[model samples]
Target: MLELTTEQVAALAEIDAKRFVEGVRADLCKDDPKLVDDTTFSSRLWRAFKAAREVGIERDENLVAFLRVEAYAPSFYEQPAIRAWLTRPGRSADQRFHDYLRVVRWHIEHPKFQGGLNNGGSGSAGNRGGSASTWSGLGARWRGFIGRGSGGGSG
Candidate 1:
């Protein structure tokens, strides 16, 4: 059996994270050509990854969901309602992510939730012109990513 040192493990993890970030960057750019011209896009994506990790959403699928949401509504995770939901007890990371998706979807579908009526409407999906097709597209992409991952695991 091959045994790795702590430093080696850390280095490998870093490498994996870097690769993941780059892959996500490429996908984002492909999805939105404008991002390709934005030099700060990479940094923003990296920050989103860090933010997701900070919230215990480290799995690739969950991270993808977070990134998609962040792309649609910048600074979404910082909203009080979203922040509270993320910190709610008794749920695993996957469960929280799924529930968060439901909440976001619900908000998007309801017109009353649009225009900042709730949560100050700052960075809310409604504030970002979140149409049903747009959010449904995001949900479809998230489902695709989740489908490719192992059935269960937090990280």
Candidate 2:
């Protein structure tokens, strides 16, 4: 008799695909260590994102509004493409949501970033074609997110 916690329920209700996939991966990794392999996790994430696409569209207003408001803060956190995509005129919310999904699906299917130390690339720690610093930031953020027990209830 498994049940979703308040945070897990909110993540689903809000269509937080990243959170959902990470949570699922953590849970699966607990049961079977091999289940958290990059390939398996990527596949599971793709499936989860695809299955939840419709829900993402249905609940687009939350993300759309958040991105829109963030755009006004004069900060780098506001992605220009997202702002333009969500705020473009003469388009319905659903249409915008679909367009957003199209971009998301494309990224998920064919990530632009493929060469990394973890991916078995031959780049050294200091020579990643200007991506080393980016990976540093990503590493910290990933460690924090995964270490926070986001896999559901108290763990």
Candidate 3:
């Protein structure tokens, strides 16, 4: 269990869980262009779990159960790993654990997960075509971290 700051927990609490995971998946897919196909629902859920853990989630088993019940998979049949992860319920536990770790690391390394920081002036806050009400916290999290102290963070 990660000991999250009050602000961090607030940030996590503020997230629209579905959008947060989707955004994380989208960000991860930005590079290869084919990365969207390369990613998986399990990876995204693992990401949500870990990100929430940073804000102090204690039970991933519950999270996994939640994912099994609530996860909405976009049609990603092109990516074998992703497709395999989503459609099959009986995959080796080891694979799921590895994917979970990958998701956690991906979240940590992701720019949006950097705590509301910016990206070389590539975009302006509340100015893009995307929904500001949706990703503003994710957009600014990295900026907040960079603009404030080294340990800076927010949604």
- What is the Å distance of residue 151 in model 2 from its true position? 25
Worst 10 residues of 1 by lDDT: 141-150
Kindly list the per-residue Cα lDDT of model 3 for residues 81-111, writing each as its tens digit. 5335534566544355446445634543464
List CA RMSD, all candidates. 10.7, 14.4, 17.7
Best by TM-score: 1
Worst 10-residue lDDT window for candidate 2 reads 68-77
Q: Cα miss at 13, model 2 (Å)? A: 16
Candidate 2: C-alpha RMSD after superposition: 14.4
lDDT of each: 0.65, 0.42, 0.42
As a whole number from 0 to 100, the lDDT of residue 52 in candidate 3 is: 37
TM-score for each prediction?
0.66, 0.27, 0.23
Q: What lDDT does candidate 1 reach at residue 51?
A: 76
Expressed as tens digits, the lDDT of each residue in 11-129 for candidate 2 is 78656666654555454455445444546454544443443342333453434322222221212123455445555678754577566545533433333332323675543233324
Q: TM-score order of candidates, best first?
A: 1, 2, 3
